[model samples]
Target: MKAMRFTPPGYGGRRRDPDEVKRDGWRKQGLLAVSLDDQRLTWPERELVRQLGERLYGARLDKTEDKR
Candidate 1:
């Protein structure tokens, strides 16, 4: 039997390279943007999208429509 070790998000076993992180982040952002643009989600889905975008971008998602 082998023991497994756990690590945090940004620092884990077999650490990811800087370039890999940047590339993957960019890809995820692209997909998220496309999904938002499609405007096919219900309220909860939209909230999830916004939360994830805020997390990945380190800023709040625009709330222009929320004011309505």
Candidate 2:
């Protein structure tokens, strides 16, 4: 197994191999994980996700918010 090492005091965040900056500095922001249940989502959008999930897999047996 690999061992974990502490980052140096002045370490910067992750960088791309080419490191070419995109418009509005998206490259510097790196990757981010957005959740479907985020409060920013509208009601219609959440409904769409629920419907799509049901069609792709099957109807959710329970009525909880954990649709996915």
Candidate 3:
């Protein structure tokens, strides 16, 4: 499986590769393990993520404050 990348919404930064993030969820808590290739999100879920990203990480808002 290729490296996993996670760029959580509302976080001001570039996408974070899986290697960069810790897998504490499995080490600390016995939560279900998610494989890089096994992780799949539904279309709706994906759309929601896109929308949230646009709202949060969208281009600087104040830059276009004037409606001229």
Candidate 4:
């Protein structure tokens, strides 16, 4: 997957790649992860990250749902 590039607020005054951010975020939240730091993230930003993670990883489905 192509990594996303974004500059976190006051993040060493530099941009960070999505892979690094996602990895760190995942480590923080485990299998179900999102932003790098939840406390630092605004509600919309957190939601965006959550949606992104869902799109990338695919949200879990119930037994009645199709896997495909």
Query: Each candidate: what lDDT?
Result: 0.64, 0.61, 0.57, 0.72
lDDT of 2 at 60: 69
Please give the TM-score that candidate 3 achieves against the real structure: 0.34
Cα deviation of 54, candidate 1, in Å: 0.3
Please give the TM-score that candidate 2 achieves against the real structure: 0.38
User: Which runs in model 4 stand beyond 4 Å of their true positions?
Assistant: 1-37, 60-68
TM-score of 4: 0.35
Error of 3 at 11 (Å): 26
Which residue pairs show collisions in model 2? none
Predicted candidate 1 versus true structure: per-residue lDDT over 1-68, tens digit per residue: 87657655767568787657766877877532335444667878877887787787666436764532
Better of 3 and 4 by lDDT: 4
Screening candidate 4 with a backbone cut-off below 3 angstroms (N, C-alpha, C), the clashing residue pairs are: none
Q: What are the per-residue Cα lDDT tens digits for candidate 4 across 44-65?
A: 8887886887788777577799
In model 3, the worst 10-residue window by lDDT is 30-39
The candidate maximizing lDDT is 4
**Highest TM-score against the true fold, candidate:** 2
Using lDDT as the yardstick, the better of models 1 and 2 is 1
The pairs that clash in candidate 3 are none
Candidate 3 lDDT score at position 59: 43
lDDT winner, 1 or 3: 1
For residue 62, give model 4's deviation from the true position in Å. 10
Instruction: Let me know the TM-score candidate 1 reaches against the reference structure.
Output: 0.34
